[model samples]
Target: MTKKRHAEIAGAGFAGLAAAAALGQRGWSVRVHEMNSELRAFGAGIFIWDNGLRVLNAIGAYLDVRNGAFAAPAYETRTDGKCLSFQAINGPGQYRLLTMTRQHLHAAMVKAALAAGAELVTSSEAVGATPEGELLLADGSRLPADIVLGCDGVRSRVRDSLAIPQERNKYKDGIIRVLTDRTGLKGGEWDHVIDFWAHSPRTLRILYTPSGENDLYMAMMAPVADTEASSIPINPAPWIECFPQLAPALTRLGDRGRYDVYETTKLPYWSVGRVAIVGDSAHAMPPTLAQGAGCAITNALGLAVALEETDTVEAALELWEKRERPLTDHTQRRAAEIAASRVLASGMKWDDEGLRAARHIPTGAAMPFVDAA
Candidate 1:
C-alpha cells in the first residue's frame, strides 16, 4: 500500500482554499492554517473572470458561487459624467464574468474545500517554512508534510524565510472599498459594471459593481496624497459633487470601509525545494486588471496538477512555476502599465490583450477529478 501525501498550506485566502480543494480531490491529505480566529475575506467585492470560474468549476464550487453572484450584462465607462464607452460582456464569444462580495466567494470556496476533506485550522499562524517541507508555526513548533505552500499575502513570512529574491513596489493611488445596500437605489446603469472617472478637479475614480441582488460594491479611488478624498469615514461632499448620480451610495459609506494602496510584488522564482509560494506572496499586482484572485486560483489548481504528474515535490514545484509563471508575469506587467497610465482604452483588441490569461484554460479544468458529494 502507498502512503498518502500530505500538504500543509499557510493562509485560508482564495489561493490557499483553492489549493486545498484541488489537492484533496486528488486524494492528498491537506491542512490549511489561518491566523485569524475565523476565516473571513477582507475586500468588499471581487471579480471572477472565465479562468477563475473554470477553476471553481473544477473544484465543484462554481454552483455555489453562481447562485450568490451577479453576472453583469456589460461593462461601462464614464468620464466627467459623460458616457465614454459601453461594451457588451455577455456575448457568445465573450468570457464569463461575475461579481460578488468577498464574503460570498470565500464561503463557497470554504464549503468546497471542506467537502473535499481538507481540514481547516484557525487561530494558528505560520511564521515561516523550510525547504525540507516543514511549516513553522508561531507557537514554537514545526509541522512536517510532503509539501509546504505559502499563500499568505504580500508580506508572506514563508517567502521571506526562504530568502527568495523579490521586489515590492507601492503605487501612489489607493482605493476605499465599501459594500452598500442596493435597496431603493434606482438606475438602469446598475445592471452593468461602471467605471466613473474624474480627471479634472483631481484624479478620482469610482468602480461601481452590483453584487448578488441586495448589495452594491463601490470602490472609490484617489491618490494617497489627497487627504480629503482618501480619509476614512469618506467625506461624501467631494464625491457627490463629482458623481451626483451616486449620491445615495456615497452617503451610505461607513467607517468600516477598507483602504488599500496599489502594490506590485515580483519574485525571481516562486519556490525553493519542497516549499512553493502562491498568490499575492509570489505575484501581487495592481487591481487595474482585476486578475489578482483569478491568477491566484488558477495557479493553485495548476500546482496540484503538476504534482500529480511529477515524480518528486521539488520537480513538481519547478514544473508548476515554469508552466504558470509566464502568463502571470505578463498579467502583472500589463496591470502595472495600466495603473501607471491611468487610462483605460475600450475595444476588442485592447480587451483581448489585457485579458489574455483570463481566456487561457487552466491546467486541471479539462481533467476529471472525484467530485465532493
Candidate 2:
C-alpha cells in the first residue's frame, strides 16, 4: 500500500483551514498549526462571493455557513447623501453572495476541516519553514512532512525564510470595523449592502453590510491621515454629520473597533521545493474587491487538486501556481486600481471586468469525489 502523504500547514485562517479540509478529504494526513491559544477570527464581517461559496460547498461547509449568513438582495452606493447606483445582486444570472460575521465563517471552516480528519494544534507557533519540507516552530523544534504550506498572513515567516522576492505596499486609506445589533434601527434599506462615500470635508466612507438577522457590520473608511475619522472608540460627531442615516449604528460603536490600513503583498512565485505559500502570504490585496478571503479559499482548494494530480511535490506546486496565479494577479491589480481611484462612478456594476475570478469554477469543485462523503 502507498504511504499516506502528509502536509503541515501554518496558520488557521481561511487559507490554512481550507487547505486542511481539501487535503484531508483526499486522504492526506494534515496538521494545521495556529499561534493562538484558541482558533478565532478577527474582523467584524466578511463577504463570500460565488467562487467562495462553491468552495465551501465542495468542502461541506456551505450548509453551516448558509445557516448563519445573510444573502443581500442588492448592493447600493451613495455619494454625498445621494444615490449613485443600485444593482440587484441576487437577480437571475447573478451569482450568489452572502454576508456573515468572520467568526461564523471561521467556525464553519473549522468544523469542516476537523470532520475531514485534519488535526488542529493551537498555541503552536510556526516561525518558519524550509524548502526541504520542514516546519520550524517557536519552541526550537522542527516538524517534517511531505509538504509545508505557509498561509500565515501578510507577514509570513515561512515566505520570508524561503527568501521569496516580494513587494508589500500600504495604502493611505484604512477602515474601522464594528458590529452592532440591528434591533430598533429604523428608516434605511437594511437588506442591501450600502456603500456611502463623502469626498469633501475630509474623505470618509462607510460600507454597510448586514450579517445574519441580528447583526449589522459597518466598516468606516478614511484616509489614515484623517486622525479623527480613523481613530478607535470612534467619535460619532463628524460621521453623524455626514451620514445621519447611520447615526444610531455609529453611536453604538464600541472599544473593540480597530483601524486596519489597506495593504497588498505581491510575490513572483508561491513555492520553493516542497514548501509553498498560500493566501495572504502569497497574494494579499486591497479589500476594494472584497476577494481576499474568496481568493484565499479558492486557491487553497486548487492547491489540493494540483497535488492530487501530480506524483512529485515540486511539480504540483509549479502546476498550482501556474493555474491559479494569473486570475489572482488580475484581481489584485484591479483591486489596486479601484483603491487608487477612491471613487465609485455612478451606475457602476458589481459584475464588471474586475470580478473575473468570481465567475471562475475552481479546480476540484466539479469533481465527483470532492463532496462525496
Candidate 3:
C-alpha cells in the first residue's frame, strides 16, 4: 500500500499547485483551496530560468512547460539605448529560458497537480491558518490536516490568518503588463529575451515573447512616487509617457490603457511549526530579476524534499526553512540591488559613489540584480 500523507494547501497559484504536485507524487493526499471560481483568464508572462526548469523536471512537467513556452537564450540590460550588460544563459544542461502567460502556466500546473492526485477547489479562499494545523476558509469552514502550506499571493489571507505579517523592505511603485498582437522588436538578439531599461530614479523593464497565436506578452515596471499600491489606473498614461521609444510597443498592448501594478513585501520567515508559506506569501520581490516565480519553484522543491526526508510535519517544516531561507535571502538582496541600480539607470543619477559601484561590475552579476526579501 502507498504511504498516505494528508496536506492542505491554501491558494492554488503556481506555488500551491507545484507543492500539491510534489506532495501528491510522494503518496500524499493534497487539497488546494483558491479564491477564484476559475483560474485567472489574463496575466502577463513569466520567464522560467534553468534552475526553475530543473525543479519542474523533478515533477515531470518541464517538458510541458517548455512546449507551451517560447525560448530565449539571454537577457539584456540597457540604459538610454546603450547596452551596459549582455548576460548569456548558456551552460551545460541549461534549458532555454521559457516565457508564457501566467494563466496558461497556472492551468498547466493545476492539470499536473490533479494528475498527481491533488484535489483543487476554486472559489475557496482560506481566511486563516494555525500552527497546530487547521485551515479556516472564507465561508467559515475549517479543515484539519497534518500540514498547512500558504501559496497565496502577496496580500495573502493565509499569511495574515497565521498572524505572520510580512516584513517590509522596499515598496513596489508600479507594474504594468499588456498582451498585444505586435512583434519584431530589434537590437541585441530579440528572439525571446527580456529587456530591462534603467533610468535614474526610474526603472522600466519589458518582457516580450510570442504566445503561440501570433500574440505577444509584455510586462513593464516603472517607479511611482505619488500612487498608492492599488491606485494605478488600468491604463496608466503617465507610466507610458516615461518610455517614449517603447510607446509604439505599448500601443499594441491590450485594450486596457494601463497595466496592473502593486506593492510587495517579504516575510521574515516562511514558516512556523506545521504551517509554512511559499511564493508571494513568503517573499514577493520586484520583477527586476524575473525570479519571483523561480523563487516559488525553489521553495516548493525544498519543501518537497524536506517532507520526503522526515515523517514529522514539524520536522519537515524546520528542514524546509533551514534549506530555503539562505537561498531566498540571497535572492531578495539581489533584487533590491538591481531595482536600486535600475532606478538609477533610468535617469543617470550616478553620484561619485554610484559611479564607483557601477564600474568593474561583472556581466553575469548584472543579469538579475534581484534578491528575495
Which candidate leads in lDDT?
1
Q: Model 3: per-residue lDDT, tens digit, 24-121?
A: 88888999998888866356666676567666666656667666676656655566567665545534554346677677677778778988999989
Candidate 1 stretches greater than 4 Å from native: 345-350, 367-373
Tell me the tens digit of each residue's lDDT in model 2 across 303-345: 9999999989999999999999989999998887777778553
Evaluate model 2: give its lDDT.
0.88
Pick the winner on lDDT between candidates 2 and 3: 2
- Looking at candidate 3, the ten consecutive residues that score lowest on lDDT are 356-365
Over all chains combined, what TM-score does candidate 2 have? 0.96
lDDT of each: 0.89, 0.88, 0.67
lDDT for 20 in candidate 3 is 92
Scored against the true structure, residue 323 in model 3 reaches a CA lDDT of 68
TM-score of each: 0.96, 0.96, 0.81
Which sections of candidate 2 miss by over 4 Å? 186-188, 345-347, 367-373
